[model samples]
Target: MIRLPASIRAACVLAVVSALAACANRAPTQFYTLLAPAEATPVPAESGYAIELLPVVVPEQVDVPQLVLRSGSGALQPVDTRRWAAPLGEELRTALSARLSARLGVRDVYRLASPASLPLYRVRVRVGRFDSVPADYALLDAGWSVERRDDRSVRTCDARYREDVGAGIDALVAGHQQALARLADDIAATLRRFDAGGCPDTRT
Candidate 1:
């Protein structure tokens, strides 16, 4: 039997202990995505155009993979154990794409070559502020615009949505999802009135 020397064996034992300690101390990360809620029947777009949803502009503080939650005292907390399934910006864009396409019954034409004959509405969203507070609410404030590709017509508007949440990570994520859904609702309505000056009334 070829056995290790005493010093080498001791060092090997120490290394094993360190690795096990790291594994024990490190918590498993949980990923979450913004999902569309069950809505009413799908309605075809009034303009019969596909959507070119640009990548969302998320706030710098919450743009990372971790969830940046707001504390009761207004301090920001980035929880590493609770992370987004994708980059925060992509997650927001994906959620909007799903909800908006479903609502308008159009396909997402992002980064795809669409024939010039097809009408396309380019939608852009920039998040001014985002806050997630457990047991309180998730707030999303964003300025979004929709531009008609052919006529260069545009509708620019900003909306702030808040959804109350229970105390937990899942509830917090669900709140944000609902908030984004509301934003989608307004945007969808505005798309129907592409050339209108005022934004849709989301009150109720």
Candidate 2:
């Protein structure tokens, strides 16, 4: 083996140490998904109206793959270790779809696609704000609309929901799920009213 200069050998050792330090300092990423509670309610047969759930629109501040936490001073911080299993918007959309489908007792609910020939009621949700303070609370402010395909009639609604965060990240996530479940319940009620030919109520 050839003898190396002292400076070069020191540089090589330093590089190896830095690489090891980086690997040791890096945090492992954790993934999470939202889930709805199981219900004992039975599914309704052929509600005669097909429902289409459009992709959810979330605020730019929190529409990320990582979990967002709001600071006491109102700054938003993304946690690198804790992350959403999917994009945050997609997760919310899927959770809402499942909740609405179950609550409405209809199998005709869909996301992104619907039968063209069938009369469809399209539901669109825009989330103005979704954020949580760790161990404090999770808040959601959202506006939604339902439009009738045949009559071209539209009904818009808005809701604000908050759930207390009890302990850790699991509690924060559970709070968000509860808030979303409440939102879905409101939407399902509106759909039922619309199906009954009643005018939409915009009040939350």
Candidate 3:
């Protein structure tokens, strides 16, 4: 057995105590979300539909759980203390799915069992950029494609959505929510016009 001197043992004990105290005093991590509580939205008068929104693919730069903030100098900063409730990609899908379902009054049966009864539109989204400039703007650039399950008709489109933001984390997240809502509106519009005409070059 190796025995330490009294002074060295006391120093080790003090160091351990200090480390524990530091950890205890650290601030708690806070989680943020781009989701609003799902509410019962009135079904569209034209016709009801169902959607299968696939897992959204986020950019590699912001694919982490931490919220990525863009600086004025175009640098990306990941804030560890503030994080998303889930991975950024999954979070994006959840937010978009809820908004889209509400906007179109459709069921999102992405992973639901036995969803063969209703007509389904398989929606896939790939996010090119998700920029968060605190108190400035929240921007989303994405290319999404929609395919009708029955007839295999497909439409691919690219869009950008930017929302001006106020200060604070909640405001930033709210800005993102608005941008997602705009995206959902465009998708709903596309679905509405899928059978009637060609794709519209709508920019947001």
Candidate 4:
């Protein structure tokens, strides 16, 4: 071993300690974790007829690969350390399926690609905003419309929902579930109206 100057030894020790300290000060990689919605409940099928949720068409404006998080200070954050799945269409599809299955006595919901020729009504949604707000809450604004197969009319509806929870992606996830539930109910109500109308051609 070669003899080192005292200043050089001190500098080396300080450098090593500084690096360790820097690492300690850094935040570990955060990951995406889902917190299930607390108010979710299954809907009993009011009508004997079973309905399937056609593949939802997510609008391009609402199309995002990852559900971004915003800190209290207004900084954008990612869901997981790794990149999130592209085109949140699948995520929404699964969420809607779960909600509908719980509320309705049916679980036959499938993507738009499903090979089912059943007489199911299709729900189309346009998400305007899905994000976290200040005060540790999440906000969702959407415009939705539903139409029966072979119908030219659409019953349009819109709603804004909010979920209050602690910060992070959990709030966003919970809020999303809440919003979807409301949308489902609205759509269900619309379907009920159509079914009760003696299958009238109320296309608009």
- Evaluate all candidate structures by whole-model CA lDDT and list the values in order: 0.79, 0.76, 0.77, 0.53
Q: How would you encode candidate 3's per-residue C-alpha lDDT over 32-111 as one tens digit per residue?
A: 88887665677554345688999999899999988777765576767666789999888889988877766776888888
Instruction: Rank candidates, TM-score, best first.
Output: 1, 3, 2, 4
Q: Write the per-residue lDDT of candidate 4 for residues 52-150, one digit (tens) a residue.
A: 555556645435554455544444533333223435566665666565556655545443343344455666666676665322456666666656655
Residue 165, candidate 3: C-alpha displacement in angstroms: 1.1
Model 2 segments more than 4 A misplaced:
1-27, 108-117, 195-204
Top-lDDT candidate index: 1
Cα lDDT tens digits for candidate 1, 1-204: 244454553444344334434654575877899865566786665446788999999889888888887755466767667789999899999999888888878888899986677798899999998998665678999989999888898889897898876656788899999899899889889888776677888642
Ten residues in sequence with the least summed lDDT for candidate 4: 195-204
Per-model TM-score, in order, reads: 0.82, 0.79, 0.80, 0.59
Best by TM-score: 1
- Give the distance in Å from residue 140's predicted Cα in candidate 4 to where it truly belongs: 1.3
Task: Report lDDT (Cα) of residue 121, candidate 3.
Answer: 89
Local error of candidate 4 at residue 176 (angstroms): 2.8
The TM-score of candidate 3 is 0.80
